[model samples]
Target: MTLSFSPSRPAYLGVVRVSAWYDLVVTAGFATPWSYALLHGGLSSVGDALGLGVLPALDPIQTLYANLMGSVVVVWALLRLVRPLAVHGLFDGAARSLFAMWQAYALAHGAMKLLWVFLAVEVGFGLAQLLPWWPSRSNEVEPALQGR
Candidate 1:
């Protein structure tokens, strides 16, 4: 007798893809407001000391362009997940590799940190495929596998 694992549900994949897309959209939306607050609301003091002052000084147009480009990349990732066949192997593989790296970063860096919570959620989205279909007890053996 042998136990078997089933393929993941389509709904799970859909949820993961949608969640990733939503995260990208929300982050893009916040970029402008956050950048504005950082530039004009006293954040420059700390940024200047940290040698990161140049970022906040970016004009709104420049910021929007950067954010839009980032959003496009994220959307591309989501589309790959939703329809893997539509993307070429090299591009899909690269996106998946990057997604894995981002997940590792989120986990190793401590997700509880304010800036990392979104990363944590992104990790969850990527890992949705690993969720178990049903709870199991360590000592339990199913009838199908009992003889093996």
Candidate 2:
């Protein structure tokens, strides 16, 4: 008897694509300054009814960082959406893993610490992209010889 196992690509790709679209939408928060209200009001807040993170100081550097990250997120999503099959899962996993690690490091160093929720989400996405491709002994098998 021989055992076989095959995982569905559509389910995994569906998760990847949906997550990418979610990234695009959520990333818009980083692209604009108005969304910074979540810093104080918590990441769940919808409006900037509270004070902005860039007010009395106009910290251009912080603004630049936010826009840059947002742009990268948009591009990343577009890539996965455009080339779901051709796009390598490992590449997406590695990129997101690095991004998540960097975000974790920044948080440890007290940079945008209030955005911990975002960090958690990033880590989740990274894992989601990786788990499907992660190597495992369970996936390996040796063929049996006939008439041995």
On lDDT, the leading prediction is 2
Q: Report the number of clashing residue pairs per model.
A: 0, 0
Instruction: Output the worst ten-in-a-row residue range by lDDT, candidate 2.
Output: 139-148
Predicted structure 2: clash tally = 0
* Candidate 1 root-mean-square deviation in Å: 10.4
**Index of the highest-TM-score prediction:** 2
TM-score computed on alpha carbons, candidate 1: 0.39
> Per-residue lDDT of 1-148 in model 2, one digit per residue for the tens?
2222212344656666877788888776676666643432444232233321212233667767777888787888888788664134446667778877887887676554445666687778677766654455223211100101
lDDT of candidate 2 vs native? 0.58
Q: State, as a TM-score between 0 and 1, how close model 2 is to the true structure.
A: 0.64
Query: Which pairs clash (backbone N, Cα, C closer than 3 Å) in model 2?
Result: none
Task: Give the per-residue lDDT of model 1 (tens digit) for 1-148.
Answer: 1224311323443554565566456444434546444434344465456554423454667567646655576666566455643112223334444766865675575432332444455455544433322335222223212321
TM-score against truth, every candidate: 0.39, 0.64
lDDT of 2 at 100: 79
